[model samples]
Target: MDLKETHISELLIAGNIDAVKTLTQQAVDDGCSAQDILEKALLPGMDIVGQRFKACDMFIPEVLRSAKAMHGAMSILRPLLIASGVPMVGALVIGTVQGDIHDIGKNLVAMLFEGAGFKVVDLGADVKPETFVQAILDHQASVVGLSALLTTTMPRMAEVIQAIKAAGLREKVRIMVGGAPVTADFAFQIGADGFAPNAASAIEKAKQLV
Candidate 1:
């Protein structure tokens, strides 16, 4: 990477949102393509952030700050990226299942998916099963991610799956489940396509699912 690109990545990892935004604008003004900025700078920085998070070297607050930095840079790049005809990796519809108001994990996964190039439609917490069905149809999403922080809400994940099947949309998308109370066995029992233990793995799982 060139010096400017390297600086962009460094600034992003450091959670310097203003610097990231300013340098990203400068890079674009200096003739850098939006794709180059995303691929070489923003994504690489987030890759390191993910690694640190997995290794316990970074905490949630730190990772969130980095995500904010990435968000700032993306604000400048997203329109240009769309205009440049760069295809998204896939579309993802994500939400916290009904009766589950916790969304920290879901939000983290959404940001990670965004960093990894998926177009994410976040339905927020307490999302109804029918909402998931509607969002899948509306977005033509390739992946559906459900999160539940409570064991009680875990069954809601199955309800959403059943609702998708009832709508005949089960085959149209891959379903992945996660959160503190979720397990691979639970995901299997619910007929979900995959389970992610955390936000970082969610990105990998989404990629594999698509």
Candidate 2:
């Protein structure tokens, strides 16, 4: 691996936005494809961030900082990736279930998904079940992620699954549920395909779903 590639990962994990911006632009100028920059630099950086966060070596705020850096690089690469026809891992629709307005977790997951090469359609906070269903249809998303931070709003995740099923699109996508109040058992009970307690595992689950 080149030193620049390692520097990109280091800058990202260190949450150095300006450095990442400079490096990404430099990579592009040096004839590195958008896909190469992503696969070699950004994604691998975010993967380390995910591992560190999961291992408690990094905190939420720190992870968000790293994600912000990744976002910066992505902002630079997005249009280029499209122009060059870079293939995405998949499309994913993610939202905080209806009745829950919390967005920190949802936003983090969305950014991480983007970093991992998923075309994410974020429905934002306090999202209704119908919105999730419509997003899946609109995006033809292979994976749907439901997040609910409140125990009371956790059932809204189940309602979203029901709505998708009612729309006859249950077979069209794999559904994953998450948030502080969600569990594997609850996900199974609600007919969710997967459950992740945090952003890193959420990426893993979403990738598996797609």
Candidate 3:
């Protein structure tokens, strides 16, 4: 039987790891490009999962399982996706600001960006301003997301932004700030290009920026 697209999405949404693996391979075998599987199946499925989570219809366990399933499928699809030369939506360097170890939010944003077709270079938590600047320069990324869960570390967002500006990279990079204590006003005050309340919003904002 042909693998139905809906079935692939259902398997992903329900966190059916084995079923997703099998069906995804079948999709590849059927001549479906890996990018097609990612964009048409995995990404849409995760979008639903994210919506459910936002609506409180899905718990963290469910979301995590779905993410795991997506990850598994992507592992099989990466080489093909890479070979296809599908231009990425954009490139992003994301990190939790200095002095903050919180990464859950940052990781979520990274995943969302990846799903939305951005090439994400995640600079793990407690990243210094210079690191962000250097990564932006190295990757030639147009967007940078700074995450901070603590009030103390939130100030580092401004520092990072200043560093980017001082390095003459401000004109080229769109800086987005987020996390529990981060506010739109704060982001503006820090000269960030955007601010988001959550990962989903971050993706939306990044799209707008680029």
lDDT of 2 by residue, 1-210 (tens): 353544998889999988999988888888788777877787778878878987999998888888788878877876775555334788889999888877756876776677678888999989988999889989999999888878999888888999999999999999988887788999999899999987778978776677
Candidate 1's residue-wise lDDT over 58-78, tens digit each?
897888888888878877876
Residue 40 of model 2, lDDT score? 76
lDDT of 3 by residue, 100-196 (tens): 8867568767866776788989999989999999999899998999999888888888899889989998899888999877899988887888999
Off by over 4 Å in 3: 1-87
Candidate 2 ranges beyond 4 A from true positions = 1-87
Best by lDDT: 1
lDDT by candidate, in order shown: 0.85, 0.83, 0.83
TM-score, structure 2 vs. true:
0.61
Give the least accurate 10-residue stretch of model 2, judged by summed lDDT. 78-87
Against the true structure, candidate 1 has what lDDT? 0.85
Cα distance off (Å), candidate 2, residue 188 = 0.6
